[model samples]
Target: MKILFLGDVVGRAGRDAIVARLPGLRRDLAADLVVLNAENASHGFGLAPDMARAFLEAGADVLTLGNHAWDRKEIVPYIEGEPRLIRPMNYPPGTPGRGATVVDLPGGRRALVLQVMARLFMEPLDDPFRAAQAELARHTLGASGSVQAIVVDIHGEATSEKQGFAHSFDGRVSLVAGTHTHVPTADHQVLEGGTAFISDAGMCGDYDSVIGMQKGGASIRFWRKVPSERLAPAEGEATICGVLVQTDDATGLATAIAPVRVGGRLSQALPS
Candidate 1:
């Protein structure tokens, strides 16, 4: 199976890129599943139901969110009703949306999508490692079970913590892709145990600004200690950044991993 995992989306530019290019990408790559981190799909904040629905219509199978999961109050109820949408699982026990789900693919293959937020250098949440292990235990990856693929989206800061999480489930999951930093990393490789790992997948928005935020506003806040107005997503043309993982259909272990960058300021990269 082939899985495409996109990084955090900033705003209109990101959404437009996905809506405009994802379909062609899906076709060209023959991707079985497309996963997107939609927390920042709204105007650099939480995702609204409309945006979520738009993403699904654009061919996203599973949507994952990060620290900004609840940035928009309207999503609270909408998340509960949409099984395809998932928030950090390690949230307090009663958090509305779930953190893990199993998606059935064609040819009797099932892919597991699990998302978690790290506690190191960020808001303290349940042990992400423990939560991840528990979710992995739900579906065994092998011929004995129909579950053929597993994709994990580690949404947080601290590359060490993200790397640790990926290594912990090295041989178990098909891919461990990071999000939240909005800067794509260069290390896209398959682990010895067969899992695809990338420190960060970057953001699907304009890179002309500071991490997808308007440069003018970000500069003011950084240049001076004074509190500046709220930051907004850069509206320039965006470069959709992500990773593509190809796994062994039999055991559901990644055989190859590659970075994908298209349009906007970033150099173009595509896996044939």
Candidate 2:
């Protein structure tokens, strides 16, 4: 199965770029599933139900959230009922929505999507490593009652923590991708144990802005410390940053891993 994981979608520009380019991308890559980080999709905050639906309609199979998952209060109910949407799994026990779910693909294959947040440089949460291990164990490939493949989205700040988590579940899961940094990492490869891993997938928004936020506004907030108004999306060429992973059916292990970039300042795509 071929899977495409996109990083944080910042705002209107990001959403438009995804909708405009995803169909061609899906065709070119022959992607079987597409997972997108939509924590910042709605005006760089939380995702509204309408925006979430738009993302789903634009070829996203599942949507993942990060620290900004609850920015929009109205989404609480939708999050609880939407199985295709996932928030950080390591959140406290009584969180509104689930952290993992099984999505059945076209070929009768089931893919497990799990999201976890790290503690370093991020809000403290349940032990992400332990949480991942338990989840992977439940969906181990080839196990009597296992799912076809397991994909993990590690939303965190520290690169070390993301790397450690990926290594910990090397063979147990099919793919482990990172998010929240909004900056794509150069490392993209299949682990020794067959899992596809990347430290960060990058952001899908304006490249000229400061991490997808308007530079002018962000600058003021940084230097003045006064509540300069909320940052808006930059108006310029947009880009889509993500990774493409191809997994083997028999063992549910990654066969290929490559970074994908299109439009904006950094425009490049993986070799077919």
Candidate 3:
């Protein structure tokens, strides 16, 4: 299974890039499943239903959200009707949308995609580990099992927590990629148990600013401890960042993983 997992989409810049390039990306990478995190697609916070529809139409098989999942109140009703859009599984019991979804591909294969949020320096939610374990227990993985691949997006602030969560489910899932940090890390590698992992996939937005936000306003909060103008996303050329994982057909484990960065400021990286 070839799985492509994109990190957070930070604003109009990110949304535009994905809409314009995702079709070619899916073809170029030969991705069987494409999962994207668009929590920040709307003015740098929360995703709008229209944005979700655009992403899905542009080849994203599933969309994931983070702490700002409900920032756009309209998404609540939209998400209820869209099974492809998911939020963190650890959200309290009565949360609106689902946290995981199973996508059946063209070749009669299925992929399980889910997102979990970390508690360290993040919103206090249900135990992510337990939440994931409970959810995963329902599905079997492998060529002959219930699903051919499993992808988990760990959205949070601490890299330590992301790494820990990836390790905890190392052998069970095909890939465990991180998001929310918006800065791509160079630690893309397959674990001992065959799971592909990266501390972060980075945002699909402009890199010239501060983690996709306009530097001037974002930096103001650091310089002074008072309220400042609303922070907006940098509307410059965007660099679409993500990771592509190749999983073994029989075992549903990752055989190779590569970082993908296209356009804008970051050094280009594409599967060869």
Per-residue lDDT tens digits for candidate 1, residues 164-268, read 888899999999999999999998999989999999999999999999999999889968998889999999999999999998877889999999998999999
Cα lDDT of model 2 by residue, 1-272, tens digit: 88999999999889889988988888888998899999998899989999988888888989999999999997899998899999999999999999998988886778899999999999989999888777776666832336777889999999999999999889878889999999999999999999999999999999899999999998888789678787888867788999999888888889999999999898687756
TM-score each candidate.
0.98, 0.96, 0.99
Off by over 4 Å in 2: 142-145
Candidate models: Cα lDDT each: 0.92, 0.89, 0.96
Tens digits of per-residue lDDT for model 3, 1-272: 89999989999999999999999999989999999999999999999998999999999999999999998999999999999999999999999999999999988999999999999999999999999999899999999999999999999999999999999999999999999999999999999999999999999999999999999999989999999999999999999999999999999999999999999999999999
Q: Model 1 lDDT vs. the true structure? A: 0.92
- Candidate number achieving the greatest lDDT relative to the actual structure: 3
Error of 1 at 205 (Å): 0.2
Query: Of 1 and 3, which scores higher on TM-score?
Result: 3
Task: Report the C-alpha displacement of residue 253, candidate 2, in angstroms.
Answer: 0.9
Local error of candidate 1 at 136, Å? Answer: 1.1
